[model samples]
Target chain A: MRSDFVRREVATGLRRNVTMTVAMVLTTAISLALLGTGMLAVRTIDSTESLYADRLEIQVALTQDVSAADQDCSQPICSGLKKTLENSPLVESVTFESQQEAYTRFQQLFAGQSIADVARPQSLPATLRVKLADQQTGADAVRQAMNGQVGVRTIIDQRDVVGKLFDFLGGVRNVTFALALVQAVAALLLISNTVQVSAYTRRVEVGVMRLVGATRWYTQLPFLIEAVLTGVVGAVLAGVGLVVAKFAFIDDLLAGIAQNGVIPPITIYDVLETSIWLLPIGAAIAGVTGYVTLRLYVKV
Target chain B: MVAMATVATHEGSSLPLTLGDGRGGIRERSPRRAEGAGRTRVAGAAPGTVPTVIRLERVTKMYKTSTRPALDRVSVSVDKGEFVFLIGPSGSGKSTFLRLLLREDVPTRGRITVADLDVAKLPRRRVPRLRQRIGVVFQDFRLLPNRTVGGNVAFALEVIGKPQATIARVVPEVLELVGLEGKADRMPHELSGGEQQRVAIARAFVNRPLVLLADEPTGNLDPDTSQDIMLLLERINRTGTTVVMATHDHSIVDSMRRRVVELDLGQVVRDESRGVYGVGR
Candidate 1:
């Protein structure tokens, strides 16, 4: 068939089935939007993990001897512990925190808390802040070396905090992905149903075309093109929706963290790239669904 | 006029004409005869040796729902450029015969050939190519409602991948041929019953098919209109394109006095040269 005539037929079909076409487009758009949001979650988690990994620090709190003897930082036991951490190859740097310095830092960090006002300088535990040469590796060697140290009460690795954050973000990504899957199925069904209705309306023309020696593909191509156009339009709308959600909702919610550079922003470039990729994908999926439905259900 | 009419190749009714999935029913036909069958004319052949374009041997179509076959042991051969009328009652095998020629319904038992090709052995992918060589007009004029008369006629050429220059040149000539020269811009409903049938005939004839099958071209038109349609078909046949028309109009059949092949209860009851509708009834 002539490309010019086929295009006119597609336009006629869309106009005739306006409501079903709209439903197909909207469902496709919403599903693609959910897919884009899922991609954002993955991007955020990835950037966050890489950004904070290099700044990781392990903190060892000084022992408190309420039952027998207290930790004396200026004595031999404390001095020996500091010397060992300072000379170790795994340790990048070690800073000794006196009770006074620890309490002052606590007050600065938690100024509005009642606990900071009641805490005494001598009662506060002195912590040894040890930065690792490798941000995420070799924590086990450091722990083994300080296993039986008398001055240490607890060893806290910054990697654990990073792990917990990633776990939470991964859970969020899973939920987003699940919702995206459901929406995708709905979009596929809507596309198939709309194409079916469109084909039903054109059955008479199709029968005539077949009798006139039109090949099966020629009869089926117009419906497939209509579906592909609907999907592409839907993908464009979804991309726009994603940009709006990012600027109007996500960026605003994370404004403080983004501004302070605590976590990298989900930039407009990321949204644009993902959205650009969706155009072809949406068209392909819609085309396949329409083609399969025609093959299986519609004779023409 | 029929140039030649051959005898039935099968003498007995017991041998089924089934060669399904390339399994059975292979026959040895002369290559020269095959080539002759493909042409509208063969120069060297005398009257008795003319090419037989269609040969059906021991053909039968049995539907699971119906206890009887639609076409039972019906063997007939149509020579090139013959205008034959298939006359029968509603339950007879006229439609089934037309469908078999088009390869729309495969016969459960038979070897059918058209234009040097075994239709039963023809692959599914080749059905379109076969159909392009044949034209069919139905009881109801199945013109596309949305397309104009020219568009409906041009559609046949367009689907076959005819170049734009060819389509533009051929479409107008076909419209003139069908006596719709000024009605090219009109839609199907804008034309009367006779004009609509004429447009359909134009679409069918535009491709210049080797054979044209009219199931009931004038089944819905009045007497005067039916006469014009039959005249148009006669003109088409004069151009050396063979036509097989099936109809229930006894008066038209009696008046035309063409070669009539009558079917009764899925069997060929009589075959007459220059016969009437019910001369054999």
Candidate 2:
């Protein structure tokens, strides 16, 4: 029939079923909030790993010296060799270390310990520190290229720590996605059930409209609009809830981490970006649920 | 005025002439000429002013049931602007005959047309539109209980998607015609039986239908109220709406002295002009 009549009918339906409508909105909002929080958590893990990867460095350690014929060498010999290696194509920079320098670094690391009583300094190995283009490729290549160098015993790549950190973050991301999916499914069930009941309650009016030559679209349009409204409100609530949680828990935890110099802090921009995308996703979920449920249960 | 007078005529037999009231008399004259010579009227002579708007041609309705048809090869036609009565006992298919005009039940054998719309093979979607052209008053009044008298009347136009302004304008006029102007805001349950039927009549006539077919319209009313409804229907018929009333109310039919088509066992037993309810009455 007329658009004005359809609008009036929809308004009447909403007014008559106010309690159910609010319940539907609240359930949708809660479920979407859970989903948004999970998504933001995954995003935080990704950003943290990216920041860690960008700043982290790989350090290579050279073992005890050997002579060219017998591979034996002094700290002076290794230092001169380190300078020669620094000029190579693969190496970005190289710093030489003597036994005395190693002893001084150990004393700084364990400051209050009686190092003279517990240990002697004459047994330390002098080495060259090497920085490469990248930890995985350039540092590995450097270690391989230096395998047969004179007075070199072994090379140690420090990228093992970076590998372990990435593995942890990957596990976190997978768990986060799984939780998000569960929340989304729950939202779908709740919203679809609510819409189905709404259609059922209005079934007599639907029947009369059908008899009066109303097409299927006209009969279902109001419910579809209601579903859209629910979706929009739910999504906004979800995004807001995430913003609050991000500030309450995540920011405080990151702040504590930054004080200890363990890591830099996360930002609200990251959370906002992730949560904003959830709005459309929420609306889509509501629309699909409304369309499918009405198709199956209500006909014009 | 009809009086019983016996006189000798040219056929060497005595004929009876009953003369009585101006509204109640029997006049039968047999043609002296040959049959079928003047039976069919020539074209362009105003189409013989009978008050029947519906015509059925060898109509037969055979449902998916037993051996016999529901309406077996029935051929009857009604003229325009006439208050015709269809009288029958139970199982005589009086309801079926009423349904045929509304196209609720289509004939299986031949064509049936109402208001010049060939209703025999009319499409299903056009049924409601066709119904809008014919006002049907049911015995139950069939008023929506939730609606006011005015709302019920406006619903007839509303279903056909008439604009609100038109509905607002026409509903009050129809309600005034039905003498229910003061009861426009009252629900159906709040009105008396006569008033409720008037509301229904107003609903049916709001769009000025071509024919008014009432299936036992006064069945639920008292005798006085039934006469009032009949009077309303007669008034509507005076304005050129062909009115067909199906009823078993002997008193109402006997008093009207209108054209009566009497049916017995799904077949017309008598087709009499100005027929009475019973010979004794």
Candidate 3:
């Protein structure tokens, strides 16, 4: 027979067996819910990381104070360092600041402290500030560029903060996947047991088909189809539940946190997209799991 | 009475057969080997009558578990349009023989040729096409509980990819043939013991198979019901379908006056023309 004919027969069989059908749908829902949550968690980590990374800017702070002998040596030293850094290809820009200018900026930061008393303005060390091409350019490269250059003591990278944030998100994604794995296994076993019982109850019918020259695949197609259909139902239910939970709870929580600017916000569309894709994937998992589990007991 | 004719025969060798008169009397035929020539002739006909439909050459089947074989070196030839009964105790391999003919199980040794095809060597993919030519019935009446009586009957046609229009048309005709036309819409549970067996018969005959193989078909039915089912099978046999039924019912076998192939401990002990079920009636 054609595959269409087999598919139709399988559908008819699933429709007739109500208990098995419901079990399949429920199993599918649970598994997909776990998987969907995992996927959404990964997306959230990815989206938020990109947001933080995009906003990242390199800051080059200029140091102050220099001896007259050192100022003459450091000025050209600072100037030569700028050209070297700018020509090094990693540097996006080279800007210079005088010790008096640095002193004036420090006075603006702490209004009560006078520039002369904080440190003699004339005695302040003048230096060059270099901004890199991107936040990803590390401090090591800048350090290497300024190596052996007098008065160029240290270099700091701004993107290190973003890297730490990504490290934290990576850990969250791992937890999400681990949880999804457990839930998927549990759901697979439960649905398989459900289908096995269905097959056991209809053993007479199955045995009859076997005696009558029906192949193993012919007998199994119906149960697999039923499992998939049930999975679809479960996925739909889980999706609805996830949507309601996100809107009713998560959305308000994220909105509240948005005001403090502490944690990044999660959107409804993101959750919706995550939930929508889970249906087919959930159905496939349920169908495959049930079929495999039932296979050990039911054979031709 | 037409006499038996034997081919490739030796001295004192003879082949015995009973030809039906259509008026219900049995005609005995005996052939004797001719000298010098390797041909034997019946009293009424010349030599070389090639009437056999199923021929087995020392076929044997041994399952994995048991030490002894199921069927041991069985060699027999059945003619077209013959109604034969296969009788044996449990484990005597009557079912095995039938399965061999249906190509459901292969013989461990020797060869079996069914419907001019070397069934023992038939490829797996072509087995379904081979099965299409043979109708099979079982003791349990293996009907799908979810399907109606008519649906069960139509299933054979459906599996072979017959058109819906053809299934719809043929289902009713077969149901009518089995005298279960009025019970078409009824499910298996709704039918009585006899009616259910009739449904199974209708399903077997529905495909218009060349041979009908029924294994303990009426083993669960009452005497009267079993007789009715036997009559249905006999009626179908008259329409040119080679019928081979396996049963322990001696009364039914004796009353039918058909060829009987008897098995005991995996060996054929008797092959009688119009044979009776010898014991355990």
Candidate 4:
């Protein structure tokens, strides 16, 4: 292979079709960026799920009468209910929150909301917060054991609340992937068209080269290199875009949620990890598309 | 006519005929033929005869859309260091005959050989190697528009992976041989039609190929200029390169008094040694 000749040919081809090359690069970059974002979201969802699992617990609220009478879970009804929960095989540990403590937590949760002001110390119910050894099956076991028991009002699984957040994140991932897929199709079309046009413009010279005994691969390698060069540039731009989004967009937008620990933050490390694969992926897509297009549409 | 005679005289004096020792020089460059000469013998020929460079035995070509074949059972043989002109009117299969020799279009039936390699049996991967041994020229003088004359000629060697030093050396020599020594820096568009054709010839001859196939090389040139190009080709032929040119130019065939193979309706109607363009002309 003549590296110098190929280099010159690729440079000439890209320069000649500047508009098409730029369009292809930008389209590929956007699609790869969206793909990388979707992958990062998946990673975030996985981490957030494991984090919630470690802290997952089932909350059993006491009846108003039991809350007013117990004061400290010393009453037989409240104390016996707590003892039953702690003795269950599914329950890892059971902690009691008195009415006053429950009222304080309620105010903290609804802080800056009018509901926090409306809540009073006696109005809130005391609860037994039950931790489990295994989150998947322990919730059902605890619910069955505590159903219709004295002093129990309602049982709430924390997983149900977390499940809602996961569903929303999953929807976001789906949307990103859908958009990425559309952009990918556009990119493929643009790449093939660019290769065709490039080959067409240089058809005369390529014909002469072939007559002069150049192999088909020799005649076609310049166009393939042009596609791959654009793909690499697009991948680099996408990596830069991801890094910039992480710093300038995602970080500020998710700051409040990240601070509250509801979801994991999009870290620079994750962006780099996901962006790293985009280079090779971009090159492969462009290379293969260029090759098939040449074989099918352009004789060169 | 006076100008044509003067150009002919000038052509004779300008070229040195460096390799004019004839078949020995061309045969020395091709060792594969020497080794395989005994294995594949041309039929009806005496043993130990000089191997033919280009051969076609009952060759036929049929295009899918056309009712009749483009070339029909055409058989011809060209020996080493011979100049053969294919002459006929339009649709006489002149182009198809040249194309088949170049392997641009394969024969629907029959056998063809060039430089001892069977044209149809050669693998696609080795097609380039076959072409490298045979240089081709078109009437359009398909020079790279963007490249200067030197670059256009150099491109042929460059694509075939010839070293830069070799290209730097041979490009000037071939350019000089074709009488374009000082016009190397001029672009194709900047030169006249004759000069442009000369550049094309230089490119084809740069590799010193065993066979040179020219399709209407002077088709676009004036009568006076065409004579000059023809004389240049005649000079190159003296250097032991087998030249096969397809043309409709009668004056050239009649004036050169060379071997002529005339075709009509895809069949060889006349094969004459030292013949004119037409019978009794």
**How well is each residue in A132-155 modelled by candidate 4, as lDDT tens digits?**
986778999899988999889999
Segments in model 3 whose C-alpha atoms lie over 4 Å from true places: A1-23, A48-80, A94-131, A134-139, A146-154, A210-218, A249-269, A290-297, B1-57, B100-113, B116-126, B145-147, B158-161, B187-190, B279-281
Query: Rank by lDDT, descending?
Result: 4, 1, 3, 2
Top candidate on TM-score is 4
Docking class of 1: medium
What lDDT score is found at residue B215 in candidate 1?
A: 94
> In model 1, where do residues sit more than 4 Å from their true spots?
A65-105, A111-124, A128-149, B1-49, B60-68, B107-109, B279-281
Window of ten residues with lowest summed lDDT in model 1 chain A: A65-74
**Best-matching candidate per lDDT:** 4
Residues B1-281 of candidate 4: C-alpha lDDT, one tens digit per residue = 22322232232112111121111111111232222223343433442365579988888899999988888888777767667889889999999998888788899998999987999898988889988989888899999999999999999999989999999999999999999989899999999999999999999999989889999999999999999999899878867788999998989988886667777888876664455677656
Worst 10 residues of 1 chain B by lDDT: B1-10
Interface DockQ of candidate 1: 0.49
TM-score of 4: 0.86
The sequence of per-residue lDDT tens digits that candidate 2 reaches over residues B1-281 is 12321111122221222222122333321121111112232222233433336877767677787566666556667655556788878767788887787776777777788876888778866666567678878788878777899987876676567899999999998898878888999999999999999998988888888778888999999999999998888767766677788898999988876666666666665544456655445
The order by descending TM-score is: 4, 1, 3, 2
Interface RMSD of 4: 0.8
Q: What TM-score does each prediction get for chain A alone?
A: 0.86, 0.74, 0.69, 0.92
